[model samples]
Target: MHFEQANRATGRLVTTGEVGASGASDSELTTGRFDGQDGHGGEDGHGGKGGQGGQGGQDGRGDQPWFELWNVQQGLWLQHQLGESRADSNLPLWQHLHETLDLAAFRKAVSFLVDRHQALRLSFQDTADGPRQRVLPVHDLDVPLVDLTGLADPEAEVDRLIRIESATPFDDLGSPPVRVKIYRLASDHHCVFVNVHHIIADGTSMGILLRELLLCHRAFAAGEEPPLAPLPKTFEAFVQDRQQWLSGTQSKSMETYWLDQLAAPLPRLRIGDYEAPADDVVNETLEFWVEADITEGLGALAKELHVTLHILLLSAFVVALRDISSDDDIVVCVPFFGRDTKDLDGMVGNFVNPLSVRMKMSGSDAFDDVVRRARSASIGSYANSRYPFTRLLEQVDAEARPGRNPVFSSAFQFTRFLPPAKQTSQLDLCLYGRPDGERIKLRFNYNSRRLAESEIREVQSCFQAVLRRILGDAAISLDSLSEPLRQARRTMRAAPRDGRRLGRLRGSRSTTPDA
Candidate 1:
């Protein structure tokens, strides 16, 4: 409930501006005025001030030797190389504000931020002992403003620009891996786009950065200094803390837990009909909003069952996947937020860590049974949240084949995450759920190499149908759900791969058409 979000009159990338795109669907991209706090954030959500003089993050360049990267960081870094070379792991965030211009204030606020967070000035290098990272001194910030109000189609131009910017890679060595551009559609209307590499930030970092930017802009607009509190801890300090934690006993315990959880030959995801691509496949996204009725019932069920909404949704996802695969063992990769302590609450870095959650299913299992299994798996993973998935992969003796993941290929998360930008992923499928008031917004991204468009449509149809039934009555048997999924799979197997919509893959279940 205390999640950080953008204030009213704010929107992210390509969500249809006020100019000439009135006919566009809101579901094309994530656009809404998320509620938030004043002047950065507080202890309740975004990190608050506690440690004083932790300037190590802001001006700690060349002060000491380079530090080791977090296990996940190293994994992402290597993933960029070992595979068909990812274009760039960039996360784009944007906001639309209808207000008068104050360019001076905006620039100052950004400069103040550059001087405050060390991540804004990070540089990586391949050292003798592998890759190491260090914070560099504050450099020039790329805050450019473009006036598009004179264009015939300002909104359409904005959309095109977003796609181009999302595909562009960052120069991590020459300057900071961030670009802030202001698109002016009118005198009182503007769109702020900020693109940062995932190495330095995650979904949570967007909220923190936006809060700081707004707080600084407000203060400077009123002809006053920014009143943002000093960060309790710097990103560098958090990295150092993790270094020591990795060598401690708690870290060892988490490793043992993971080692036991994923023992022996791991299961590979085989839902898609096409063969896994030799290289990174062309990724595509299918986003839709769950029905208001289903959303209401799911919340009620969660409350009745004494579990969080995340557990409920994740349970439904597990059941849907299980029905399609008809496999007894289910492994879904779920990433957990890594802001474990207050010291890390405000720091902006790659703090999202992944957990390879495995669930065992039986034919006689009911909806409630799967919920309990999901709850247990979730709680256990949360307890051992520090264990890195990359480390687990190294310890697990799974086949190292290209294309499909040797371990779990499907991933699921119930968090405010970045929209699909690169259109490429190491995994075959990913489901992201973000809570929006009474309804839940879902984004399903799939690899074309592993799954055809029609096949993924079947997967989505199956999930919604099974979810509606589960919410209606938890006592329904899982054995009853497989017939629909199995039939859909058969239909997909027989359908031509000429790229046509597989409308109504399931027998009478309503499916949200491609957005």
Candidate 2:
């Protein structure tokens, strides 16, 4: 699970950290009492140093390493999606084929994914204590699988297992790219436990893993070894290419714009009433999804307005926040997939970072005007989007609000375009439940993982209202989104929805009432 770092100049292994107790089960070596005060320091026992830590490994070609090219702290972390199964699910497809989890095939798949992606094979080396990147050959990422059939209620059991499995973070330069623990609940029921160094994988990579898992599984089951296509290029290539393309002048301009944006005293827009904390785990999440139709509408509007869908979404969100808080100046974190590199598609590593979308809204600004502003902000951020949100925070040394998010209220993200839901061969999967009655804080974090179908529809309702108010009355200001924004505001902060499950939506009305 751990390896000593190899001396770059000597090309010999240099050991560090207490060599873990020999043959220690990942559980045993990783087990420890963390009071939350100790933080994750103990877990990262010198195994995988992400871009933020060590000097990333370089290539023999004297080229820039892929790890260095991507934003530091961006290429670390993975996303997983858990959904309900339906009787009408695609179980037949799975049943038509053998559904066995073969280790050899899995290893081949892992090796292929790692070799194809530069981020996975990237490592750091040293010269006179100055460490840099050393890209390693792609090899099969070996992860010992523990069969936890003895444990009942696998979900609950797996949660405990994740805590233990993730206790020891990847700290050393390069040993195992990813650690996976497979929990098989039944012949047809199983869960994949994956622990990726936040430096190499992000939410997008998770989608890639699931898709390839099924694709590889099918090919293996069919008794045919699929000949994998070679990667168009690697992350290392990307670094060299991007740097060349954005030489001195272009880089300076981008850097200057970003610096000026950060020059302002960052707005601390409070979303909730919580006593600031000395230091807290602070898993502030904002979960909501736009409806399929509304998403289409936004896409259409973006096309018409000559902006990206993300820009439109960000604009509406800013308008909503400004209206609710009655603050003209606001900021929110927007997570971007920082690929900016060609030939990075299908790479199974973290390549995401947060960007600050600072909106300077005016009371008199029209909704369309706000849209234009939001679009402009996104484009500008992209031009000067080299630094990670973490780096920006570090630069400012911004004091985090005691119990709240440091910079702004929370984060906003959309994930509908990820791999579609898959059908299984075994049990019928139909979700029937309601959210628990808990007062979620407003300093919310939004991503694709948490929202339900009904909730997605509700969000659509609000967006529709906002869009109607905007387009219907061109003179209306971005403040017009306030009414529809209130619907979601009410649902999230108001009393819980009657906790209904799988109920048909009652209204089929257009957003315009007087139409």
Candidate 3:
């Protein structure tokens, strides 16, 4: 049976898969010879101006195609080259299928997906104009199938494969940014590993790719041609649109707003302080889930406050940071998926823009008042979110700080779209979620060099405490609540092993607030 679910962002019912259809069997899907080189010029049919032909300027290589880089892409590319230490941008999407699968149909489905999305076929090349993306023509990209079914330790081998794949950097100058591999543990169990560079895809792009890939797989397995929709806009078209928008009046106004908003010296969260300089900085994440009940309460509270759930959570986070840092000014880097236009919704590429949100919190303010302040700040930031972070930095004349990001040291994001996982007729497919679960996944990506894991945990605990207290009584003064809450915790611990106190303890423990 085909299952349909409403896309949280778009509210459109998306078809997960179709039950059965007849045309050609899975084995027959791969019968045709795939001539890797036989494809049309890279830019023939896509929207926007077709791909530029000749390489120009001293920076361009004669053999590679060149296209302009978006501001965010340029920033990331420069950081990858100039930063003393590099964090690998290669991201792996791993899935374990618990049923016997036809490799032929799977490969065909992946090829179909690659052909459909223009961004998947792109690589970056350094040019006189900075880094430019080059799009490759459709080819029979190889999906390596490794058989580990006979290995002495299959589990260890699986881990080894994952480690190697995750650590391997993508050859952005030469090869396409995506790699695929399949490992067979037994006739009925297999694991699929797909690694792609962050430059070419984001979480939303991955979801789009997985959904279409699964649809194609089911169609091919059931002896029918895949019924996937043509992309509404090409990645190149989106890039062109973005460039035009950035040069327009609206972008200038937005840029001005950011310059003023961030004019004050950026406030650093009191998570930790690392003075020594490190060549490379690696980020560590703390993963946790907010239970359905608390999540529901948050949603209700968001409605009552006339703000988004994200805004409410961010308000509590600001209060928590204030409590820890004792600094009234708190700035957080919040990620915005820069897909405001409907045309760019399904197109794959790096569309994430991290914008700084500055919120002023006072200990004496009421919880509701702080939430309103956060809401206003959030609304203003989001209204002008399309301005590129790199351009904003230049506009503000902000100097890069040693061992830290310039404007904001901390980041926050709440994602509703988890990784796509589904079951088909012959395969029990499972695409790994962010932290792998149904409840909202809150990932706190922090600089390991600056902030200790213990400090992050403390921040998490403080956020939870503040959120619960506010929910219990939104009218409470922020200053009065903190001490009383500490005292309440002490009283609860001292009261006894009675049911009432035990219930209170359970409530306290359940509030695993997102960072």
Which structure among the candidates has the greatest TM-score? 1
List model 2 lDDT by residue over 212-304, tens digit each. Answer: 655665576667754445444445554444445345564556556655775657665432322223232222222334445545565566677
lDDT of 3 by residue, 340-427 (tens): 5544566777776766679876556888898878766665666666677766777675556644466765555444543222111010
Candidate 1 Cα outliers beyond 4 Å, as residue runs: 1-57, 60-64, 79-88, 149-153, 172-174, 416-418, 421-423, 435-439, 484-515
Each model's RMSD to truth, in Å? 9.9, 16.4, 12.8
Candidate 3, run of 10 with poorest lDDT: 423-432
lDDT tens string, model 1, 1-515? Answer: 12222311111100111111333222211221111211232221123343333222344333534777775677656665564344346667677778876888888788778767777877777789988887765567868999999999997898789768866876443356878888898889877788777677776677788778877888889998777667766666667656666677767877898888888766655566434354657778888788788888888888787777777788888877766654567888765555655555677777666666799876678888888778776666655665556666778778777655666778776755434434456677888788877788987878886677777776777788777778667878877666655664555444655553333222221221210
Provide the global lDDT of candidate 1 against the true structure.
0.65
Q: Return model 2's CA RMSD, one decimal.
A: 16.4
Q: Which ten residues in a row have the lowest lDDT in candidate 2?
A: 7-16
* All candidates: TM-score: 0.80, 0.58, 0.74
How many collisions between residues are there in candidate 1? Answer: 2
Error of 3 at 16 (Å): 25
Candidate that beats the other on lDDT, 1 or 3, i.e. the better one = 1
